[model samples]
Target: MSRRRRKSLPAEPVRCVIERLSHDGRGIAHQNGKTQFVDGALPGETVMAKVVGSRSKFDELRTLEVLEPVAERVTPPCEFADLCGGCSLQHMAGDAQIAFKEKTLREHFAHFGGIEPEHWEPPMRSPDLGYRRKARLGVRFVPKRDSVLVGFREKRNSFLTDIDRCVVMDPRIGDRITDLRAMLYTLQAHDSIAQVEVACGDDAAALVFRNMEPLGSADYERLVAFGKAHDLHIYLQPKGPDTVHRIWPEQGEERLSYRLDDFDLTLKFHPMDFTQVNAGINHKMVALAVEWLDVQPGERVLDLFCGLGNFTLPLARRAGQVVGVEGDDAMVVRGRENARLNDLDNVSFHGANLQGDFTGESWAREGFDKILIDPPRSGAEEVCEYLTAFGARRIVYVSCNPATLARDAGVLVAKGYRLVRAGVMDMFPHTTHVESIALFERK
Candidate 1:
């Protein structure tokens, strides 16, 4: 061992002006024919960054200082903007962030898919602050800090940041951060509590606490009392997601819910349901998808990955028949219930694994006139292929991942579909998250 000497890593400091932002929010920079991805530097800014890591293609650096600040850069309003890993582009101006996102969307569509939308709907904007309706916050017992750390993850680390408040959360949830911490601290097994997932809508806000063990009697009483005092609903997760149950009030069932005004549907969901994190952007997204689909009376439509009938009920209003398909049976039951609640007979829900074959005889002859897909970040590549022969004249693809959207779009284009229009919606405002809708027509 003494005969072999280990080589130390190279120390290289690169100073460069950020030219643009990548999809993941890293500032792209180039200098002396080498490309560098600098963290914490915004576009159109000069900064000195110390090289922390590098790959064959790109170099990674942490910004030391902004030698020259861009006009679009501003002091982030949230005390946790840089510290909280939940959002990255908060320091960039709202308008500039939207512009960058739009440009990025367009580039993805054209460059990756080799397809161009003939028209573009202006990017939908939401209240730049206090808009997040869903979040999973991390909880840690930091003995050195003499307080429980309750917040999101720190930048580039799994350790939870000791955040007192989050400005981007809905006012109701944002204001309760300190109270939640206090209450959690009172629990008998405070060290066993991991994090709390917060979901809010018009009428109710629910906090689902994920714990490693069941709560003791004292802990249960403290949580229930806190919930009653704040008019909040509390759910406890002792094990897996199926184990999540309401611990507050000791009795009665209240389903967590969110309303989609554009859809005219009030969806009842479990505390653990997968709903959009941004309520404002979700409403706008439904409206945009409906508008792009151009639903007409007597037209049959298919809504894929339809969670709780977000777009299905809205489509039912304008189309003769709307079929909502989801992988979760529980969600399908809720979706059907929502349709019945709205008294919409034209909407039908089916539970099927969307990633699998969806073009069997029973699924093949649906005769849909239009289709709407809001798949997860995985994108609906296989589902897009299955829809090519479904006789849908128009298809509206709503995507949360631009790269996967671009890949699926390429598949659609090759199958005689033309991208008619595409646009972005600023859903997760402070974060680098991109939500976009694209319209494709059979050629």
Candidate 2:
């Protein structure tokens, strides 16, 4: 017998004032001795929310009415902002969002790290819409709606949103959302299609479709014709990610690639590989970070969490020697390949789990003059502590989470490093996601 279904809890209407915006862009409010997270609310605003889901400690709600509006709030440009779940903070003005992100970074650093930057670089801003180069789109058939949903998940739900377009995604993907819906609908294996992963480069855009079953010959022909018509490289994943294979009219190139002209670098990535979603700002960020590192010929540099050598190869152009370390061996191998393609022998790779303490002499064995660390959201507390002990003269840290960055900055300051400067990069544009870079010097 099939497993029984779990009934969803009924929603309750409640009125509250949004106190702040969380990192994920959810509005935070407290009511009736409990914390509530509501979507589509701005800080310093009164609103009625319908509690949709609840955990042991907190409840997630949808804003039912805006009783009092905040000055920072603005109408979102995207038609599907509320329903698509692609962006949650779109209603917040761009400037106000940047200010909040900067404030968040400072507060996190002070609270977690017990130190603050002596100087702050202004928040970087860019085009807010159509900025994303990569995204994962869900595929769902809603019988009640009598339509197929080909977009992100619904607000706070696993079910796919019924969307015809997405404004935040790159035009390559957003423009094709409706076409994708139609194409899947025409396929004999429509119910078997699950999702599509999109990745775009300067020259090409690729889409990888996740399917529950193998494609029939007719299904394959339809996909090939579609790829030819759209000039898209289509890959099909019949099972796991490892099973992904191109199923277009032609084999095309084996990999998708992006170019960085500032450092004369070209990085190739698999559809599932981790590359910065915003290519334009990523180049600018690289320039800013390299300028701060001030690499000189014959200087030694260490690049940590170096995925596919995004920063390592660029540093290699200026530094005499650069060592890139990452936890994933596949990334390390790819990084090496990129270095070979660029014909830059100055950079090398090492595989290591960077989140652990580097107390072992072997871990701190490298004699480097400068260090560049771009850690994940967990922050670089362990690595920062190791940096203090290793005594690198200059350290440039790139972070996606301010709270974690602040926490790690405290460790560096305690270890005799001064945060000289920091700034936010609007890599995600309209979204509340914060990407920041900080400089520290051994005092």
Point to the candidate with the largest TM-score. Answer: 1
Report the lDDT tens digits of candidate 1 across residue range 1-443: 46765444347666788998877888999866778888789888899888776666777787778999989888989877766788898788899888888888878877874667889889998898889888899888867765788888877778787777888998888888898888888778888899899988688888888989877888888888999999888889999888888877567665777777655678777767888888888888888788888999999899999989888898999998888889989889889888888899988999888887777746447678999999999998888777877888999998998888988999998999998888889988978888888999999
lDDT of each: 0.84, 0.84
lDDT of 2: 0.84
**Which lDDT value does model 1 have at 336?**
86
Give residue 236's error in model 2 in angstroms: 1.5
> Per-residue lDDT of 267-371 in model 2, one digit per residue for the tens?
888777788999888988998889999999998888999999999999999999999989999899889989998999988898888878654635347578899
Clashing pairs in 2: 109-406, 113-410
State TM-scores per candidate.
0.93, 0.91
Least accurate stretch of 10 residues (summed lDDT) in model 1? Answer: 1-10
